[model samples]
Target: MNRTPPSARTGNRRIRWPVVAGLSVVTAVITAVLGHQVPKSPSTSPTSAVPPQAPRGQHRDVPGEADGVVPDGVTVFDDAIPAVANLDPGLLKALRQAAKAAVNDGIEFGVNGGWRSAAYQNQLLRQAVATYGSEEEAARWVATAETSRHVSGDAVDIGRSDATAWLSEHGAGYGLCRIYRNEPWHYELRTDAIDHGCPRMYADPTQDPRMQQ
Candidate 1:
């Protein structure tokens, strides 16, 4: 591709060779020393271990997928979640009233779990069995979908020690009673509790006659 005439080429070849060769040598040496022909740019974002959730109802159902899933920070006022929204009107009303009063004492009510679909309750029972290593042991913790108070929107699991403690002290007036001594967070609406005080706890769900159903 050299377009110069023979005479001109001969005249300039010697003068250009050293400079061109020197530049080439310098570039090769730099490339060798850097161990790359080009720099590798860093990624702005790295991939996460957990996959991202699909949008809304379009999401695929895994074992844990169910209507009563209450993520952290869901409160009694959060009607957007099916767990809180589908609660029994009487139970929901009592919880809301108690939550409103709790604010005056510097306590906010956070809902851990509430009204669960049948599938959700069954999932919980399976989880309980896995955790306890036996269905008999698990029965003390979780109930069948048909018998579960959560599936009927009659029970709720409140969050945080301080909030439960506040409820323990004052919940009876609102007809909110802890059903299980082992589960301080679990509460149910007992309209009679407002007048007669809370009935004896069942120790765990296993003692409750309703679980036999």
Candidate 2:
């Protein structure tokens, strides 16, 4: 048997230990790199996974109440002659009740107009003056901005001849009355009309005391 030299054996041992240490160090480095990368990759996923929330006060289903416009023939706002949102609260409530009653009776009450913005009222006055050829003549058709009940949100223009006719007979019970004989479409809240019945219709808006202002 040949005897091994101690120096040679020691040299071999030293070479093996270094290789093992090097491999261990490489493994630790790979693990550290992977650990650092793993944290960053998951960070983005959590943020992206969060669901979006709806905006506050956004009514996705109803457009009329949300926008306050209630285009012609769309009557989602409380069955008002149009949308009742801008009308006086009391007046709107009365109109809703009256409209509901009308609906039950097989008449679909509608509003062609209700509650005018000051700008809109002014625009109507201007248009009326242009058509009628004078401010005096316009007053008979459209009230001054300051005196218009439509601007005050206490008035509405009922739509459809049948709706108007139904109201002529039954509206007094709801405290609604036609103010102008010439414009049967125009109606106003007169709670007194509920008890005493609507005051006799004026021959026209010009004859209305409220419009005299």
Residue 200's C-alpha lDDT in candidate 1? 94
Per-residue lDDT over 54-86 for candidate 2, one digit per residue giving the tens place of the 0 to 100 score: 888785343243323446674415544333677
Question: lDDT of each model, Cα atoms only?
Answer: 0.91, 0.78
Cα error of candidate 2 at position 97, Å: 1.1
Can you give the lDDT of residue 185 in candidate 1? 97
Candidate 1 off by > 4 Å: 1-60, 63-66
lDDT for model 1, on a 0 to 1 scale? 0.91
In candidate 2, stretches whose alpha carbon ends up further than 4 angstroms from where it belongs are: 1-70, 76-83
Model 2 steric clash pairs = 81-110, 81-111
For residue 58, give model 2's deviation from the true position in Å.
33
RMSD (Å) of each candidate, 1 decimal: 11.6, 10.8
Q: Could you tell me the lDDT of residue 15 within candidate 2?
A: 99
Q: Provide the TM-score for each candidate, comma-separated.
A: 0.70, 0.63
